[model samples]
Target: MKIKLFFLLFVSIFSNAQVVINEIDPDTPSTDVKEFIELHSNIPNFSLNGYVVVLFNAGSTSPYSGTASYYAIDLDGYTTDANGNFLIGNSQVSPTPALDLPETTLQNGPDAIALYLANGSDFPIGTLATSTNLVHAIAYSNTSTTQPTALMNALNLTVCINENATSNAANHSIQRKADGTFEVKVPTPGMNNDGSGIVFNYLTTTFNNTSYTEGQNVIITFTTSSNVTSPVTFTISLNNGNFNASDYSGNTIITIPAGTNTASTTITLVDDSLDEGDEEFILYISGLPVEVVASNNSILRRVEDNDYQISNFGTPLAPTYGNVTPTIPTGYYASLEGLSGSALKQAIQDIIANPAVVHLHSYADIWDIIRTADQNPANHSKVWCMYIEQPMSKIDQQQGSSIVGKWNREHIFCQSRGGFQVALGDTADGISIWNTTSAANVVDGISDAHHIRVENGQENSSRNNKNYGTVNSSTVYAGPTGTQGSWKGDVARSLFYMAVRFNGLNVVNGDPSEYNGSVPSGNIGDLATLLAWNAQDPRDDFEMNRNNYIYTWQQNRNPFIDYPLLANYVFGPQYGQPWFASLANSILNTDEIKIFPNPASEYIFISGIETPTRILIYTLSGQKVLQQELSTDGKISLNLPAGIYFVNMKSEEKTETKKIIVK
Candidate 1:
């Protein structure tokens, strides 16, 4: 009988493999033993080369009498079968022959297994795969030391998305370890719109200051970290001395625009060569997938002699812009309203007929035409003022040619001759001494001519030859009743009552009431009364003794054509003795007068005296000098020339000398 029909078909395949090991029930409820370990394996092709084993029926429910251990195992070399199955293709199935796993995991048994299959209280209990094997799991309540809640429905991992991470994608996660390493956690997506926060950022791409001095146009402001999430695109290079990225590799590229936040970028480097010290630059930045690099030690040095010692270059931070304060032209004089009252009355008659324009007035005539056209002729041009009427289209055509065409157009102010006028010439018609009555009566108009007098027969022969009689009198007084009246009111109070009724006369030698008889009452007298009557009788002792006897009979009746013929003189090379010997040899070659003991036996000191000038001493074989006269503590004391000597000094305008030695 065919061996009794193969022993009854091996007892009906041994009772259907003992009814499939009595339907595996080691106290089930691990979600039905993880759906019976995912219907018996193949969890996404696990691989670590071998052994996923994970069996744990301790204290058995009769699955062949329990106690078949081997939990968590997958170091891949295969070895585990006391029910934690792992012999998929013969990795020398050792059920305990003293463990010998990794022969590349028994020649790739579980194809170098890498299974996760976990469930030991969640929170990362297991589920990673992909390796040269290792996942020795376990747990079916072998007093549960974890892992094997049916290997968490046998494994299926693969999740980590990132792209700068977070933003709510359910906290993407993926990790694997037991010596297989792969972690992926992902989550950092915060700070980036300028408040700067994602930390860990760096950037210094090629900012070279290599002692900076070769047409140095540096403004290197490259401080990064505006919370960069992306958009990093810098590429600058200078002094190109290999700072990496193949010396700026692909040259220039800068994009930085993905959640960028509050970015910053400035890279200006100009060091055309020879900066002379530590200079390396290269800032190649390419999107950052994390192998970052930024180096710039162009150690900025070349401020040679420290470019005037840095007064301010950086680190002040706060004034995004704002400043203004410069105006001074000595506070710009109220813009002189178009100056010109006949160009300020011909700059006040050229500072009043400049006889060195005494006591200066008319406010010093436009300050002497702006201090002689700003060559600053000794400033004191009496602080300019023409009684505020400048309107000659705002003068200053070079100060209106120092008072426009020498003005004096017959002394201006002439509304068709209704007020002030002048233009006489015949010896100026004896300066038409006022009193014409009306023609708008300017100081009682025209010629009442009496330019000076007191002769009642020379005041009775100098008061009877008493001789103190010349209190001014050349004898022109025909007034009193020679009638020329109508001088009316304040023409400077009627010329100060006709100069107090001409008593003992004195008025620039021609007093017809000291005629201010013109220019609208000629600034109405009292210029301190014509400067106190021209400081007392300036002339008129009978016309200065009749012009001193007609200039002594015209120089004795014309001696060599009456003086005034030094060859029609016009000389001026500072007109003199070689201009005083070239100004005393430029003050003795600028020694400016010093003397000190120069070999003097009894005395020599004479310090740097700048001007009491008068000392002389001579003896170096040119003899004939000894003078003395300087003091004001500009010290002096000298006495001889035993060997070498030459002092000279002199000073009414300069002369100096020195060369002492008198031991």
Candidate 2:
């Protein structure tokens, strides 16, 4: 009690920053890199603007009451951390010192450290110490019997004893004790004087298993080191991207009572109809008592959905798209077998050049074709419009002047570029190649249903006749989700079809000037971009379905839609490779067909098949084992050895294949 005169004389009773020099470590084992001084404020996040730390040197030869200051730090514009502590130390000291000191910066002598609420200019490097406006001051030494220093009287700070007599100076630091006296103890820089940095220092959380299911309950255990005298509580927070409060039911707060060191809480999950397949969340701990925090901040958890199931369509092409059998006769491509390169392209052009195979209504009859072909798969009452790629009502045809939701026929191969039925271009769909073949060059009259698509009236005008390519002035479509990417492939395949069925109108990749054909006698280009688009984006089901519907109209199908890689064999990189029907993954679109009791010994029942075509069973090695017409009840009898086999169900419109195991 008698050695505490310095704090009583200097500490202000009504000061705003209430900061105290908490701990000081002057000497380490080697260099002074670990030396540090810790400051603590009673008010958290307190601003230490008008404060300065001045180190006074006792080496002054004069016998005066004051000592000359060796170093001073201006505490302007610095605020204490959330823990109300401002730490300063040499470079090696951590958790990152607020004021970094050079190695061996602090002198290990009968030096004094002073905290003052004054301007930094008041304490020059050699200025003597003063008691004016001093906040807290402490005098420390590395030796027990230290030389006399003016800090004893100038700041009324009595020299505190060092640990050189017992623990040695390097292993100990002088820290302020609870009774307001300094003692040589284990060095604690940023922690409390009593050596506590955490309130519940031994608290931990554990879970038996991390996986759960919807409608199931999870219990998390919270355990501490020793029994509490009263109730201890903590809060559990969630950090899943889609965590809704209503999706979970729990108290969210766990509590442990006196005489017990462990507690737990239950979290009940509410099912979301299993639409979300698998859900994951991280639990965070917070809201503990004052000065207390959880040792483990977060815990990861995953829940499986019980009702999640999917019915796949066609032969899924991995991440996107699926192959659907083209609506063509069995021997449709029999003439083009074993062909490659330009020869294969010429054969395809020959097969589709006959205009008699295609059925087209006049350009005036395009509305009926679009209404039937572009019907939305989700809402049949609406028709899908190109260009803008939006869904418009079937009745919203572009009439006299009401053009809000109206759509018009978009000639993908523009009218001036080999796409009109007359020289002057009447709206009668196009000048029919009728009996004339695609090889015959018609200068100004050509129109077919394959090149015409539905588009919004305004968007049709917005895009006028600009050739499709990587042009900076291109419209970006956002309607109907994923339309932008799919529309590119759609337009690319349509243009490829036009280049074949209408050979007079060339599609080139050269200079844009060569394609200004007001009479349809010249090129219509940027074919390089169109070919790249064909290779980049595969044909999706929307295009496949549209191709099949158009086949019903013209009796001719777009071979590119059936064989996605055909464009490559003809106009792309693989120009000379022999093409095969097997390369085309065009197989099944039976989304309704179902085969149950798949791993069967003798028989299996099938359902949802439209027209009973035939059933075939094959081994994994591609050897066919059984073939028979499908019964009306959708039943097939099979007896095979214990192995994996594929059951291929053929229907009038599509085919379905499911892998099964023989019991």
Best by lDDT: 2
Q: Write the per-residue lDDT of candidate 1 for residues 1-663, one digit (tens) a residue.
A: 999999998667533431001011122111111111111121212232422433333222332222222333333543222222222211122111112222111110011112333332221223332222223221222121222222222322222112112243233222222233323233111111122322334444333454443234444444444546556555444434423332122324455565653333443333333323223342323334332223222222223211121111111111111121112124121222233323322222232122231121121132222222111111111111111111111111222212321121111111112232233331222112211221122321122111111112222222221111112454322113332211111111222222222222111212223223552222122122222222121221222222222222111111101111100010110111221112322222233445676667777767666556677664533454566687533545555546655565656645444455577
How much does candidate 2 score in TM-score? 0.37
Q: What is the TM-score of each candidate against the true structure?
A: 0.17, 0.37
Error of 2 at 38 (Å): 92
Q: After superposition, how far is residue 73 of candidate 2 from its true place, in Å?
A: 96
lDDT of 2 by residue, 1-663 (tens): 655776664454335446888888877855556888888887666788889998888873444235889888899998775666777887556444667665566777677888998988998888988899999988876666674466768887665556464545567887887667778877766567785444433456777676787888878888776776778887887557766676688888888887788988888888767455456667777766643434344455776655644323221122235544557788888878899976887888777766555554444555666676666554455567765656665556787433444687787767765645633443444323223334454432244566678888877776566677654544322223344555666677787777776666666653244233454444565655666566455676667777877776566778877775576556554457688776565444445566678668788887765565678776654467888786555667886788756666656534445556689
The runs of at least 3 residues in candidate 2 whose Cα sits more than 4 Å from the true structure, single-residue gaps closed, are: 1-324, 401-404, 422-446, 473-483, 514-518, 586-663
- What are the clashing pairs of model 2? 363-428, 363-429, 420-431, 421-430, 421-431
Model 2: per-residue Cα lDDT at residue 285 = 74
lDDT of each: 0.27, 0.66
In model 1, where do residues sit more than 4 Å from their true spots? 1-197, 200-231, 235-588, 595-604, 607-663
lDDT for residue 183 in candidate 1, whole number 0-100: 30
